[model samples]
Target chain A: MKGILRSLLTVIKNTFIRSITVLYPYDRIIIPYNSRGSIRLVVDLDTKEIICDGCGECVNACPLKLISVEKVSHDKKIKNFYVDISRCLFCGLCEEACKKDALKMNFNYELAERDFSALRHDIDKLTEYAKPKVKEFWKS
Target chain B: MENRKIKDYEEIEGYDIYIEPQFRPFGFPVGLYIALKDGVIINIKPEFGYLTTGVEKVVEGMEIDKAIPFIDRVDSSSAISPELTYCIGLEKTFKIDVPLRAKFIRTALCELSRISSHLLWLTRLANVLGINNALHYCLREREEVLHLIELATGSRLTPNFIRVGGVASNLSPRFIEEFRKFFRSFRKNFNMLKTFFLENELVVNRLNNLGVLIEEDAKNLAITGPNLRALGIKKDVRIDDTYGIYDEISFKIPVGEKGDSLDRCIVRMGEIEQSTSIISQAFYKMPEGEIRTYTEDINQFSGNTRSHIECPHGELAMEISIDEGKITKLRIKSPSYNNLLAFSRAVLGESVEDVEVILTSFDICVCEVDK
Candidate 1:
């Protein structure tokens, strides 16, 4: 009988407390800056150009071989870069292996798609969502 | 009466046999075969192999550094323990020295994971017990711990934070501040939870004296963790085998006198308190230094080593054999596999209604079992 009263008191006290739930679609919680989200190509702040030199360090660093890099010539010019997000683990190995600060994991987590083909992100798709002026938290 | 066959098992005249197929609420596909007599359980046979990803086979021949992500998924709820065990095995084999700051951060993260894992168990137990309010409260506290992990490791469930020699990154200042805030309020909140759930008449009446496991039977079945501890055995991998900085940290191993379902719940609640104290101690004694040590050449190292740690479930150990940078063999001794055997034994002679209660009390992770 005492235990029942205590539990009832707790339930009553909880009624006055504010709810911690964030109603999704109506309101969104702020994601942390360093969260491992979708992969994106980092662009130079002034030049506005993708900073990848086509060195393929990220390709070697990736354990799953989801990243593919192509170079046009020996002058460090990138021809095509692609990332298959279908099976990406998002371990941030590619971002850590980039010596040129050209690759990063941005804070865009909403990557749901209806079609399977749209999941494969190319250089244009990667750069399309790239934030130019966002401070790099992983570097620190 | 003539003998008959049901689902490949011989059915006797006086007993009833049924197979409980995997359900959605159980979170994993682990079928249970129960043999009943007079509404009491005569036997229980657990089935596995429904969710096997063959993690050990896939990790073979891969570099030691590259296997962290794969290992982190073995037990996704408390991912840090397996990752830490794998890193410790490689570090011991290669004789690599981890920085002190990294060690402190690792210990803190481990305790945090333990707290979160236990809270998850509590949520499941509450759900099984039909206490919806307790489930909500447990989930709320678990979300706080997961958020802290996300703030530090960039991911919540699978942090993949621990590396071979040290951790991947240092603790941020915001994380430290939030941890302090969490530590301050968690004590009061947990007290409220205890009053709301553990001390309730419904939970006490339902769980007390149910599914009692004897110490001798538990030892025979090789049951570790709170289940064994509930039988008054003071056995813990963290204490017995002093891994990481556990020798430096001071914490009590909570044990229960009776090996009943309620005793298991009480022991885990005590453990949550001890884990919180451990995190605070690690935070206080944490030193400022490098988080990782750069190894010049890891491929030239070749040896075999084993490392073990006390996970939230029980003892989790990893055995690794490396041949000049490539892993030749990797074996994970998960606690849930042994706990499943113990569960099959503990469920005997109990009524059918208490089966879920006893199962959740053991807190068996089928993913770990099938891994």
Candidate 2:
């Protein structure tokens, strides 16, 4: 009975002393330094330039064929390189194939879409979504 | 051992016969221990099917290009490796060779991903063990690595930037300079991780000699990755099988002394150092070349092909059967699948509290296991 009491005390001490569990979302714990969150692509719209050739290379590169690149041409040259984010693998292939470096992967991870159509992002929307900003992380 | 058995009693028959307790009289992570009364475990289980998604089956019927996201979702923790492996497999099957510059960048980013994943795992491990400071420290460093990947590759987690025959494009001069700065930081953080993970008293206490799997056990089960390397065996798919520009850069395959949890951690930590070395070397000697593999004639194998890589997680193997260059059937084999075996061996005889750490030490991904 004495030994049992000692063990119970030890357990209680551990439970109380450890400040391990975080009240997430409210507390919003820091993700590890190298965490892989969500797939993001960057479009430098400040230059008003699209990086994707929209040749559908990423569309072809995907093992699933989920990507749909609908290219809009104004002049003889390309105008808009639209993409279906819903179908995109977020595999970074589009960014990989974006030889112009017009397509980059940004760290903005939260994309909880309400519907499939909402999941889709055209070139214009993608450009708007490509702003670079590191999310605030708590040290403690 | 002696055992005692009582004859069925009339008093217990109508009382609903409480065969098993309904409420788990323990922690959040419960251990399921089922065994024969003859001192043998019929089954030792953890109610660990929560983090499950049919990622593999999701990708099977989809086109090669469409399945990338589903593949990344397999293990949110280390999703990039799976996606990258699949892309490499496609490139090989399609007979596309990327440019020289693209190859260097892929090598750099892939190594960066490796460091990132390791840091995450280490932090998670620390979290479970009540080592808050260690967890925070590791998480901080891991963020920097992710930022570098984002700076270079664009996305923090799901950067599907590595295309077939080449990377989407090359880093700009400014970004390249910043990336070189990241290269130094990666090396510095990796060294810190090595020292902390390998030498920290609490980490050492929690990990070392806690689990034991000898060579024969690992061999019989065909376990791969850091777990296998922990047994002091060097069987990396990158070196042995040869994939990407891994053949180009000089990197060492770090191994450990024992097939214990500590050994596994040590191997992973040492691999981080090796990965860091590979990165710096690749960065400095990053030759001017294509980041992708180009294909002239897409009409190639017209059948099934298997490609393997020594990913940070383990020997990540991918199986894809193509009919006229469109991926028909895709199956993935991750290192976590083999490493899951270490659980029953590691957890048995130990108290239930150690289950989480042991589960973590193996780094078992439920998605990978189910897939």
Candidate 3:
């Protein structure tokens, strides 16, 4: 029974020590370097060049069929890419197939949206979402 | 009163426990379970896959190599592990070994993926336990690990780095240096997690004797990996000295004495440390070699094949029947399949409020279980 009291006392101590949890939305957590967030097709913003060869590999990879890479280049290339985060499991298989590193995983867990369509993005929008997290390691 | 000379319920080799004892779990099948309480768990009953999307069936009709991405979807979290298992299994069947460099990178990516998966499981359980602070912290570290994967493989989750023969690409020196730094930083912060939430007495109280899976029942249930270890059975496919370069490395397999919620947590934490050790060793010994070893001349020793991997959950066994370099049949038996027994047995005689604690303790993956 004394052990139970000690355990209770410990819980009380911890509760006091950890009462300062961040309120999540009003005060966001600065994501660490190792967080896995929504994935994106890598697009080089400097040149607007897409590394995907329009192979439809990613489209074929997704179980949910959340990706559709299309190429409007003169010869039906897979330059334009679309990913629907709503359906995407964030499995990272689509990025796995891209030999060019054109698609990448970036941390941005705040992907709450009321509209379902907002989850889907074209190649251009994916580039916007693909921003690298400038993780402040020392901040911790 | 029943005679003590007869079965004392405790002395019985096994006992049967229906999980949905209140009602038949057919129409409203959120979760279904059947536990054999032969002094522990004997057999597990699950019907989550009753309504199937037929992923494996669909793959049989598709082109062979095109199946990598589809395989990733089977259990979505750690796509790299499944991809590696399938790609390597296919390569082995065709007698194609990847370049030394690719093999090293493959192991590296696999460890990162395992860490990411454990992080997800940790957060999920912590969330269920109402410890949201740990969830954020775990996800934060998971993002760092994902970035390391991202730097090498491009995609964070579904890294298709490993092809049938060799890995598709290589990691840069700078990326390697950065990744090593990240691993070091993560190590420093890991111990604080225990202090953060694990040390909380309420958490331990909720988990203490809840969902107990004794030794004998664990073995009968075909329990493998950490779940088995949590039951005081030191059965780990990885340490069994099996395939996929595991023999080349040195590591300790952590085991638990009581198959309770706390023991399960200890096993997972021990795995985190052990996985880190393996990654560090793989990192130091990485060699440079051609990543892929398949020939364009498809006619190689290809018929039917199987390869095995020890995942964070347990033994990930895959069997493939190939025809003309294309996969005819691919059957995956994930470790998640056997864990249901442990989960269901742990929940019996448990307080209603502690159900989620037991469930989360088992680290049940709905997708993997359903798959």
Candidate 4:
């Protein structure tokens, strides 16, 4: 009987405490600074061009081979880069393998899509997602 | 009606009952086949292989460094154990010396994983016992631990933080401070949870002396972890086979007096306390050094090695045979396989209603069993 009363006390105490949940659409929780979400390509702040040199480092580092890089013959620039985000492990290995800091994992975790092909990101989508503001936010 | 001869039901064999398998909310599905007689279980057989992903076979021929992510998914509840076992095995085979700071960080993360895993088990047990409040409380505490892991390793369930030579990144001061704060609150809340569960008359009566697994059967079956310790056997891979910075830190292994369902619960609860102390010790004694040793020429490594660690479930071991930098053979000896076998044996002679209680008490991860 004493145990039952103690349990009841605990239940009562918990009832008065503030809730820890956030109303998803109305409110949001602060994600950790180091949280790994989706992969993005870093762009040059001044030139607005991708900093990747088509070096194939991330391609080699990827275990699942989700990344594909094509280089232009004229100036060793990235002609095309594709990432299959549908099957991406998001393990952050590609970001770690980039030598020029051209690859990063941003906080844009909302990657759900209705169509399968929509999930496969191209160079334009990747570069557009790497906003200069996001880089500055992480610096702090 | 009088011309027909009636057969005696007692002369026939025991009835066979098959429990339809269903997907557990946590993942994996388990079914049971029971032989019943007079409301008692004559024999019980557990069915596995519902969630097999061929983890071991998939890792074969992959590079050593790239296989960490796949191995991390072997046991989704505690991802670090198998990754650590595999990394330790590789490190041993290639004769790589992990830095002291890396060792301390690994120990801290591993203990944190243990605590979170035990909390998850507690939530499931509470759910099974119809204690809705305890279930919610356990989940609330478990979320904090998962957040701490995410803060440190950038992912919640599968950190993929530990590497072959060392850890992925250095621990920030903010993470350490936050962990200390969490530790303080967790200690107090844990006591409350203990009293709420253990001291309750309903829980004690329901769990005490139910599905008793004798020490001899546990030993003969080669059971490890809390289930084995519940039988009053003081055997832990972390102590018997010391690894990482465990030799530097001091802690006690909690043992139980009886090998019943209640004893298992007590032993796991005691483990959560021990794990917290270990995390504090590892953090306090942590030294300043590099987090990872530079292993530029990993492709030249070639050898076969086996490494085992005390997982939250039981003894999780990984064996690797590398030839010219490619994995030729990889095998994982998961603890759940043996625990499932023991569960099968323990449920015999118990009433049919106690099967779920005994199954949850064993804390079997079908993912590991199917892997």
Q: Which segments of candidate 3 are over 4 A away from where they belong?
A: A1-140, B1-29, B32-47, B299-302
TM-score of 1: 0.95
Best of the two (2, 3) by lDDT: 3
How do the candidates rank by lDDT, highest first? 4, 1, 3, 2
Q: Which candidate is the best by DockQ?
A: 4
What proportion of the real contacts between chains A and B does each prediction keep? Answer: 0.64, 0.18, 0.05, 0.79
- Give one digit per residue, the lDDT tens place, for model 1 in B1-371: 23433534553333455544457375657777787878889878876888899999999989877888888889968988899998888888678999998999999999999999999999988888888988898999999999999999999888889988898888889999999899888998899889866778878888899988877778787878888999899999888888779899999999998898989999999999999999999989999999999897987889989988889999888888999998999999999998888888878999988888898899888779989
Provide the TM-score of chain A alone for each candidate, in the order shown.
0.87, 0.57, 0.67, 0.87
Give the better candidate number (1 or 4) by DockQ: 4
Q: What is the DockQ of each candidate?
A: 0.60, 0.13, 0.10, 0.69
What's the TM for model 4?
Answer: 0.94
Best by TM-score: 1
Ranking by DockQ: 4, 1, 2, 3
Which of the two candidates, 1 or 2, achieves a greater lDDT against the reference?
1
Angstrom error of the Cα, residue B275, model 4: value is: 0.7
Computed on alpha carbons, the lDDT of every model, listed in order, comes to: 0.86, 0.64, 0.69, 0.88
DockQ for candidate 2, C-alpha atoms: 0.13
DockQ, prediction 1: 0.60
Model 2: CAPRI class:
incorrect
How high is each candidate's TM-score? Answer: 0.95, 0.69, 0.70, 0.94
